[model samples]
Target: MEIRLFQLLVPGVALLFIAAVAVRYLKGKINLSEFLLSLIFWMGLGVFAIFPDNISVFVAKLFGIKDNVNAVLFLSIGVIVYLLFKLYAEIKENRRKLTLLTRKIALKDAEELDEL
Candidate 1:
């Protein structure tokens, strides 16, 4: 199949997502493994980005994987799962902090009442 503009978009999307994750983690001050894994991911994305669709199809066949579209789709699922877990953990931590703060405020209020 001829590589059309629409086909090129598959790799572009992957690269964009990789960029977002990289920026987010960097801003969060995460180190080492995260950066390395992101670098590897960006490499795969770069393969798809720098080369045409035919190259990906050839490599995918050699690797016993699916076509470029399916490969991108599958890769996206992993990103989605990671984001979901990250969001869940963030929400849980925020809730814990909120609860702790609420308890502290209530205790302080109770102390003030006792003093009055």
Candidate 2:
């Protein structure tokens, strides 16, 4: 079995990200759920990088995919779409909150001016 340069490099990068996430978590910069999610993602990335072929083959078989490449592509697309949906939802909630806050502030200012 021949080891490739990327197999080592990718895992090394993943470890660096994991360490960064741990430090942020310890410093209370991110919540517990965020920390755990980051940890799991980084760990999985490192493991997948180290065993891409084996994992891809397993995924292909598990999903009844005819080709490993196609399986990976589909999996990657699914993850991206899920993340996008989550981001969109967060943004929508933020916008709703901002609108409510703005309205409250505007009403308070109007009342103060009228009192003068």
Candidate 3:
């Protein structure tokens, strides 16, 4: 078995970072869903970093990609795009809620002023 520096280095750093995030989640700095999703993502990253060939080859075969690296690249881009859309939706919802709350407050203030 070949011991590659990258395989060790990447996993080691990722594990440490994941641990820190887990602690923050426990302390209530982050939500449960976010923590769980991040944990799963980091663990998968560690596994793939250690055995990239396995995942790349599997993906390439499944997707009919000519190269394993291309398979990995394509999958990564897809994940990023999905995450971006999710974030956009969350931001839009938050903006809508904020607008509703501001309107309610303004109406209340106007009513109070009329009473005065």
Candidate 4:
């Protein structure tokens, strides 16, 4: 089997990220679920990079895609959309919390001024 530069480089980078995530989890910076999810993602990335053609072909068949390239593209876009949705939801929640906190502070300040 022929080894490509990207096959080596991608796995190396994935390993680094996996180690970082493990360290973070050990330090209590991330929960078990986050660590496991990150571990799975990085391992899958490394495996995919190492055997791109084989994995892509499998994915294509599984998704009933005619072409492997198209299958990869479709999967990538789906993941990106999901992440975007999650980010948007988090941002909306943060905005709502901030608005409530601001109103509470404003009411407290107004009450203090009325006393003065």
Candidate no. 1 TM-score: 0.54
Q: What would the TM-score be for candidate 4 when compared with the true structure?
A: 0.86
lDDT of 2: 0.92
Error of 4 at 76 (Å): 0.8
Q: Which window of ten consecutive residues has the lowest lDDT sum in model 1?
A: 47-56
Q: Which residue pairs in candidate 2 have backbone atoms (N, alpha carbon, C) closer than 3 angstroms, thus clashing? A: none
Tens-place lDDT per residue, model 2, 1-116, is 68999899989999999999999999999999989988888888889889999999999999999999998899899878978997999999999999999999999998999953
- 1-116 in candidate 3: lDDT tens per residue? 69799899989988998999899998999999989888888888899999999889999999999999999999999989988998999999999999999999999999989953
* Tens digits of per-residue lDDT for model 4, 61-115: 9989999999999989987897799789989999999999999999999998994
- Clash statistics: count for each candidate: 0, 0, 0, 0
Backbone clashes in model 1, listed as residue pairs: none
Best by TM-score: 2
Selected candidate, larger TM-score, 2 vs 4: 2
**Superposition error at 19 for model 1 (Å):** 10
Error of 4 at 69 (Å): 0.8
